[model samples]
Target: MTVRLDHRRVGLDRESLAAAYPSASASGRVVVVVFLHGLVETERSWFHRPRPGKARNGTDFGSRLAEDLAGTPVYVRYNTGRRICDNGRELADLLAELVEGWPVPITEIVLIGHSMGGLVARSAVRQAGDHPTPGLSKVTRLVCLGSPHTGAPLERGVVRVAGILGMFAALAPVARLMALRSDGIKDLARGSLHQDHRAEYGRPVDAGLPAGVRQLFVVATLSRSEGSLWGPLIGDLVVAPSSAGDRTQTADLEWLGGLHHFDLLSHDAVYGVVAEWLRT
Candidate 1:
């Protein structure tokens, strides 16, 4: 019943991409921001909303971002099961169509990616810069929320565990199952995105960042005792601050305390900071 092998894609792929633009139905203000979800996530993940009255304890970061910008944000619903570079390549093509038939002239283009999505976004932007994508011309900003720009430490643990499991006959099946992670997940390895030259998943390379495109990284810490010994080890319980912040190379870093991985999605403080960035 579902179309496109993913979404209900009855129309042309280009048509689908064009239709996803926030400016398609809006007027004048043609600032479009594309929001990409993390691993194993889809467009629906962005629409996560809490109860009508519960704002503080809600789970709608995408919608909350729209409210902050006073505009709608475009959601990219792709197969997270695919390799990040593969998705990034497709995204580069899609963005061309997304803006080619813009009902209104696009004034600004922004990308906000979460986790693996951030890697994809980074890859796509690099490809766009090399290729001819209309969307790239107007790209002014890129914001990554809890994105492991360097690599995801948790994924390494999984790989190690998978390797260990394979050594036992009884756990071989479990190892195989765990090893079934998408190529995208495997690409989350250390320096995965730092390919000397882009090949596949090593995406919108921090090294290959387009000129004039402002980049912002936001990292969250869950430990109440950030200054303690295990603060870096327990950062958001997945990505370490050193990786998330990338402070040495990346100029802009925002560190927030008391938030986990998903918590970065809908945190009010984060929204406020992003909103201010958008305004400027």
Candidate 2:
């Protein structure tokens, strides 16, 4: 489960960095915007079909941000089957390498993540704290879209059902099949950030967001009104709104109704909120 830069699998070597970021090298002290994709997804997921009347090319959020904001947009692709913490550790190292190898100085970094990617970002921040990752100081903001911060009900349900099935010898095979899910998927049961927190699944962890970094939690619901019965119950068809934004009272929160989990990936409304927050 390797994490590479963009779809081209850009390496972190000095030569690759020089080739990939020549323009950034020419620019002075630029902000770096990193986009982290969700579970079972690649960086290409950000490239949605072009919106009508909008630009015909570069339809992804990263592309749009490059045009609107004064920053370098970097899309990271990784294997989703690995544990979140494992990926997070690697990501922290990768970012540190990027900082060390960048052609120009970096002023700040903004992380925008979707679904499981958000959890990975948080874990990366936490892992960065254990060591002196120079790039960690530059992370100024983190944006989570439909992330299961507290936990995801679907994962919990699957675990429960798998347990029940395991009790019956006749259904043990099916139970084992369900348990064969990737470690990354299993981490969603409680949004376990640290390795030690895995045992405390039923209880919520108080691992707060990184200090000095602005945080934004964006939740999407299929219901027209978030206050409706289905809103919290079927949030984005994967994550619960309460779990997604329950981490901090200080972080900015946005609840978008009548949208599913995947919709947040390319939704204009989501981009508007992100752009506005970044601008401020």
Candidate models: Cα lDDT each: 0.70, 0.80
lDDT of 2 by residue, 127-233 (tens): 65676588777888989899888788999999999999999999999999998988888888888777887875545655555688888889889898967986878
Whole-model lDDT, model 2: 0.80
For model 1, give the RMSD to the true fold. 4.5
Off-target runs (Cα >4 Å) in candidate 1 are 1-29, 49-59, 62-67, 165-174, 194-205
Off by over 4 Å in 2: 1-6, 50-58, 247-250
How would you encode candidate 1's per-residue C-alpha lDDT over 1-280 as one tens digit per residue? 1112134442324455456543455666777777888887766655555334434657466556666675546667777666777777787776666566555667788888888777777777767656757777677788888887777888878888999999999999999999987777777655345234324322333547677878888888887665857778899987888777876544477888877887666667777777787788
Going through the candidates in the order shown, the clash numbers are: 3, 0
> Cα miss at 65, model 1 (Å)?
4.2
Give the range where candidate 1 is weakest over 10 consecutive residues by summed lDDT: 1-10
Cα displacement (Å) at residue 24, model 2: 0.4
